[model samples]
Target chain A: MRIAVDCMGGDHGPSVTLPACQAFLTAHPDVELVLVGTADALAPAAAWPRCTLVTASEVVAMDDPVEVALRRKRDSSMRVAITQVKPDATGLTRADACVSAGNTGALMAVARYILKTFDGIDRPAIAAMLPNSTGGFTKVLDLGANVDCSAEHLLQFAIMGSALVAALDGKNAPTVGLLNIGEEDIKGSEVIKRAGELLRQAGAAGLINFQGNVEGNDIFKGTTDLVVCDGFVGNVALKTAEGLASMISGFIKAEFTRNAWTRIVALVALPVLNRFKGRVDYRRYGGATLLGLRGLVFKAHGSSDAFAFQNALQRAYDAARNRMLDQVRDRVVSALQAMPAAPDTARQAA
Target chain B: MRIAVDCMGGDHGPSVTLPACQAFLTAHPDVELVLVGTADALAPAAAWPRCTLVTASEVVAMDDPVEVALRRKRDSSMRVAITQVKPDATGLTRADACVSAGNTGALMAVARYILKTFDGIDRPAIAAMLPNSTGGFTKVLDLGANVDCSAEHLLQFAIMGSALVAALDGKNAPTVGLLNIGEEDIKGSEVIKRAGELLRQAGAAGLINFQGNVEGNDIFKGTTDLVVCDGFVGNVALKTAEGLASMISGFIKAEFTRNAWTRIVALVALPVLNRFKGRVDYRRYGGATLLGLRGLVFKAHGSSDAFAFQNALQRAYDAARNRMLDQVRDRVVSALQAMPAAPDTARQAA
Candidate 1:
């Protein structure tokens, strides 16, 4: 399997991605790396075996506007890396999947423009894993892809998310939960209510395992295998969790390092504290996948270090090996086929 | 000042509220308490000094629907407690404010029915204080009141939230942030974009200290004194934080109690751990204030204990003493006066 890497993306650019790629290659001897960047950026990786360098003239900065990244910097490394995964005239792709840590907006825009969405999927969604108390990760989708989604879009998200989880976690029928303010069916906005009805019908038809509505706390409770919502709500929830975790960590550090007596206590509790830290570490969960696209694409955090970025590459390689793209395509097609005409509005009158 | 208490509410009913009122009265010698509940429930507090017992036959259950709480349970302790804060025929209220630990939906419905919204305010919002890294609380509003809010409603939330922070935190001009998915003005949904324009205009006119847009993580970072969002997003964010915090705490406890060796470390680190816990304790933050109402009302968590309930009472007492209602009314009137006509659509062509 081959994975294309945008070596000149993210905060540290090649400094971070190159080391991550080298480490990833070392771990997975069966995978080849397609390093996309400027010649100067890709020079160090040239000596590495099983690596091919694809040079581009410009680099997409972390803060570049979507228009600039798309129209102006046409030869940027981020665009070239994503392009490698696009099918050629012969219906063959140069790379199985792509990984980048550049501007999220630009990446999603470029990916959708190049690869396009699969049939029965109007827009692609971003899915990420959140660590839960059940000693497993809860898959949440539409993290920030489509801010204003219709009920049909949410249904598509559920279908795509279910397939991704089944592909990666090997759960033949993963339980799906609709993210809402309350557990009741009549709890959310009009769009959410419509989405719930559509999801229930799809679940009844054996398209996906819909487990009713779930509150925000249920996400961390591991109440379901996958939690689906619009990109706006999902993005806010993900960021809120990140904020709380950060605050708690800060508070813990402040308490443990307050004085000499506390410092001694920290020494004795170092092992247990480290163990707790390892459990909640975001890096181990890998990167977010831009699902519903024709080809696989993983987005590493922009500020990710070597270890974190390597995990993202590993995630991309794993998805490719497990044929996640095929799983998504098949699942979406089957689910859409089983769905009623105008699912969002058909049951509204009832 | 006299504050009404709903004794026959929450999980423990009188077992929690009775003890909480006793403790509150002891702390505030000048303040009187109107304990509202069934006669049997109020018997224990009958002989208590500076306390009056108001009997109500019914109690609103935690799972009661809004319709049931509104139409069926008219003489409920929750209703009676809120009624105490409502003005009489001569425009004089029996109690300065009211506090209840009942069903949120029921409480909001009953409260709105008994005490209508203030002028220029379409709906009442639930506002809560979250402890931030700066050792201060970030006041967030509309925690599940109105799920579908227009840009004007968001603008109202900003005005009300700013007044709340000013009254409670003693900041004359508390900074307000529109809770959004991104910091950029071009991001978020149509409602958010229009809300941004209204907020900017309000900020320039000195109606509010609007600080542009803030992401979810900014709440804990204490980037602004107040963060305003629609009820749906706010509720989800609050609950998501709760979920993540609970998971982190569970992970910590599990790690420390893994074995006898680790247990000893927990023993030594107990002080530091407790200190950290105290900082993030929701109980210390008190209850959520129902803003944009004709009277003062606070909603404690349904599962609150004696300590938590007492904190809620203290919050009610503080708000009443500081005249938070008057501040909110004045701010809203001024903001609406300064806002452009059809603020949501006036500047769309611009």
Candidate 2:
């Protein structure tokens, strides 16, 4: 398996990406990496086993506009890396999957334009995995893809998310939850209400396991295996959780180091505290996949270190190995067909 | 000052509400409490001085529907408690403020119908106080009142939230942050985009101290004094934060009691950990105010203890004494007039 790495991406470019790729190559002996960035910057990483250095002149900055990244920087490392996954004229594949920790909007823009969205999937959804109370990950979608979504768009997210979970976790009928304010039928906006109806119909038709509406707390509770939401709500929920976890961790550290007496107590409590930190570590969140895309592309945290970035690469390798894209192709087709012809009209009439 | 206590509301009924009210009355020598519920249930609390027992035949169950609570349970403890604030034929008020922990939706429905919305405020907002990094509370409105909101509705929330913060905290200028997926101008939905424009214009006119767009993390970071979001988004964020805090606290407890060695360490660490827990205590959250209403009504957590419920009553008493409703009325009028006339259309044109 060959994974394309956008070396000139994230807060720390080649300095972080190079070491991550090297470690990933060492761990996964059968995997090769296509390191795409400036030649000189990626020189140190060339000595690593099975690493192919692909040169690109431009870099898509973290704060770059989507148009600038997508069109203006045609030779950007992000754009070039995405192109490596695109089938050539002779139909030969250079890389199985792509990885980037760059600007979310730019990465999405470049990937969508280059790989295009999968058939039946109107737009691609960004699905991130989070650790839950059940000691497993729950897949949540459209984290920051499309800010505004319609009922039909939510149905598409449900389909894509269920497929990803099923492919990766081997759950034939993964439970899909609609992220709403409440579990009651009358809760949420008109779009969510209509989406719930469509999801229910799809569940009855055996397209996806639609768990009724769930709230923000449900994501961490693992009430469902896959949670579906529009980008706006999902992004806020995801970032809010991150912020809170970071803040609490800081509080814990500050408490343990308050004074000499507390510092002695901290020495005894560090091990247990470290274990608790590991349990909720965001690094273990791995990568957020651009689900519903024609090709597999994973986005790591821009500030990720070597170990964190390696974890992201491992996720992409696993997804590629499991043929997640191929499985989603078949799943999306049937799920689209199973959906009600006019759920919006039906909900209104009811 | 007088406060109406819904004795039959919350998970604990009279057990929690009565004790809380008694404590509140004892703490505030000049304040009185009107305990509204069944006469038999209120018999014990009737012995307390300045505790007037107002009997109501109906008790609105926690799981009751909104319509049933609003119409069928007209004389419910929750409804009757709110009516104590309504000036009777003699034009005399029995209670200055009302507090209930019953079904949030039902309470909002009954309160809105009875008290009615303040002029220029299209809908009432639920404002809950959250503990920020600065050790001060940041008020966020529209917790779960209106699921679907227009751009104008968000602006109304901003105005109401700003007034509440100023009235309670005595801050002449409270910085308000508009919650979005990201801080960028290109992020969020059409409603949020237009709302941003209006908030900006209101800021220019000195109606509010708008700090532009902020993501969910900013809520905890104390980046702004107050955060304004629609009920749906605000409800989800609030619950998600609560859930995460509870889960983290549980994890800490579990880690400390894992083994004999850890348990021994826990004894030494207990003092510091307890202080940290108190810092993030949800009991400090107090009551969620039904903002933009003619009368002051606060909804305590359904599962609150005596101390928690008492804190909620304190908040209600403080609001009444400060004339929060009157302050909001004048503020809302000026704020609405200060807003740009055609922001929604202007956003679309842009």
lDDT scores in order: 0.90, 0.85
Q: After superposition, how far is residue B255 of candidate 2 from its true place, in Å?
A: 1.5
Q: Judge candidate 1 at residue A321 and give its lDDT.
A: 92
Residues forming the 10-long window of minimal summed lDDT in candidate 1 chain A:
A341-350
Q: Which stretches of candidate 2 lie over 4 Å from their true place?
A: A340-350, B89-91, B339-350
Candidate 2 lDDT tens digits, A1-350: 99999998999988888888877887888999999999788878767778889999999999898889977999999999999888788966799999999988899988988988776777788999988777788899878887667788898889889889988899999999998887986778878888899899888888989989998888888889999988888888888788788778877788888999999999988999998888898887757999888788999998888878888899899999999988898898777667543232211000
Instruction: State the lDDT of candidate 1 residue by residue for A208-298, as single tens digits.
Output: 9999999899999999999998888998999989988899999999999999999999999999999999999988875899998999999
The digit string of per-residue lDDT tens for model 1 on B268-317 reads: 99989999999999999859999989999999998999999999999999
lDDT of 2 by residue, B1-350 (tens): 99998999999999998888888888899998899999888999867999889999999999998889988988999999999887787867889999998988888889888988776777787898887776677788778777777788888888889999988999878999999977876568887888898888888888989999998888887788899988888888887787778778777888999999999989989999998998888887758999888888999999989988998999999999999877898898786566543222211000
Clashing pairs in model 2, backbone N/Cα/C closer than 3 A: none
Query: Residue B347 in candidate 2 has what lDDT?
Result: 11
